[model samples]
Target: MIGALLIILFSTKDVWAPDNINGLILLYNGDIETGSIVRVEEYNLLAYAIQTTLTQTVLEI
Candidate 1:
């Protein structure tokens, strides 16, 4: 999960430079089925929260 997220993030930032992290996430979630769905959703929400918090923190700094 974290690996996928890192891939996605790096891909977004043009850092690690994957062609399609979104596709990878879809394949991963599909392969794992219900558990993956739940976990991905939860992780996404957590990631969003963390990102928001970090952004806010950086702004305050």
Candidate 2:
């Protein structure tokens, strides 16, 4: 019973990994992006792209 529970617990990590949606970003150019928001500055917003594994900054929006 304990071993089965452990297996189930570990498997859930993989299943929930992709479901992590930090937030949404709406750009002024009419493009939408979903990722983990890094920072919000005066003139720009920075976020870590989930699909690309990189940081993106939007100056207009």
Give the alpha-carbon lDDT of every model. Answer: 0.39, 0.49
Best by TM-score: 2
Please, what are the lDDT tens digits per residue for candidate 1 over residues 1-61? 9999977887777633343565466455653232222224543542111111211211110
- Cα-based lDDT at residue 14, candidate 2: 69
What does candidate 1 score in Cα RMSD to the true structure? Answer: 14.3
Per-candidate TM-score against the hidden true structure: 0.23, 0.24
Q: Which consecutive 10 residues in model 2 have the weakest lDDT in total?
A: 21-30
Clashes of 2: 0
Clashing pairs for model 2 are: none
Clashes of each: 0, 0
* Candidate 2: tens digits of C-alpha lDDT, residues 1-61: 9999999988896665443432122343324455545556874766564443223333332
Runs of candidate 2 exceeding 4 Å displacement: 17-61
